[model samples]
Target: MIVLAILTGVLTGILSGLLGIGGGAIFVVAAVFFLGVPQHAAQAAAIAAMIPTAIVGVVKHHRNRLIDYRYLPYLAAGIILGGMVGAYVANITADIVLRRLFSAFFALMSIQMFWSSFRQGRKAPAKQQDHDKH
Candidate 1:
């Protein structure tokens, strides 16, 4: 079980880095489906796990000069406040409702990503032509 959890964390971390996503998406689903954890518990665990992973990511990006420090205060404030609100809401929500909400959120995000990718693909030809004219 420990080994499985570790593997899940490793995979989640890799996906987070590759996709520029918080690991909660991967971690929650993996914990619930693969690890047989309860949905609410899984979400709580994922949120807890993200702290260290996010810190490391931020540090690496900061070192590479990829972060805009100017936005940190605003972003941090929003995150802290939003996290409190979300945690409170989640605690009051039914487990099944939370699960459905999470699933719907992922589905919508996937659709949006596909649509964005398609739009980018459509513009690529025009972009290439403009580049050639330069």
Candidate 2:
């Protein structure tokens, strides 16, 4: 179990670095398949793990002046509301239902992303804009 956890963590870190994602998918899938954790617990754990990661990323982005701080309050408000609704739904739903839902959602997202990339490869490049107009 410990070995599986460590492997999952390592895979999550590698995927995060390579894909610029926070690895919540990795955590959720690992918890479900490997650790036998329920979907609600997996989701909660993924969110908890993301907090520190988001903090670090935000700090780094802030140091580089890459953040728009003024919009944070609005984003935070929406996130809080969504989190509440998600938790409520999770509370009422069966574990298998949540797991299946997450799995389906993830699979759809992957398929859509793959389709997007495939379509992108078939598109012709647009003409470059001349930016030095006087």
> What TM-score would each prediction reach against the true structure?
0.89, 0.86
Q: What is the C-alpha lDDT profile of model 2 across 73-117, one tens digit per residue?
A: 999999999999988998899988988888898899999999998
Which number leads on lDDT? Answer: 1
- Count backbone clashes in candidate 2: 0
* Poorly placed runs, candidate 1 (over 4 Å): 125-134
lDDT of model 2 at position 82: 96
Q: Where's the lowest-lDDT run of ten residues in candidate 2?
A: 125-134
**In the order shown, what is each candidate's alpha-carbon RMSD?**
3.0, 5.0
Candidate 1: global Cα-lDDT? 0.92
How do the residues 63-130 of candidate 1 rate in per-residue lDDT, one tens digit apiece? Answer: 99999889989999999999999999999999999999999999999999999987886678876868
TM-score, cand. 1 vs. native: 0.89
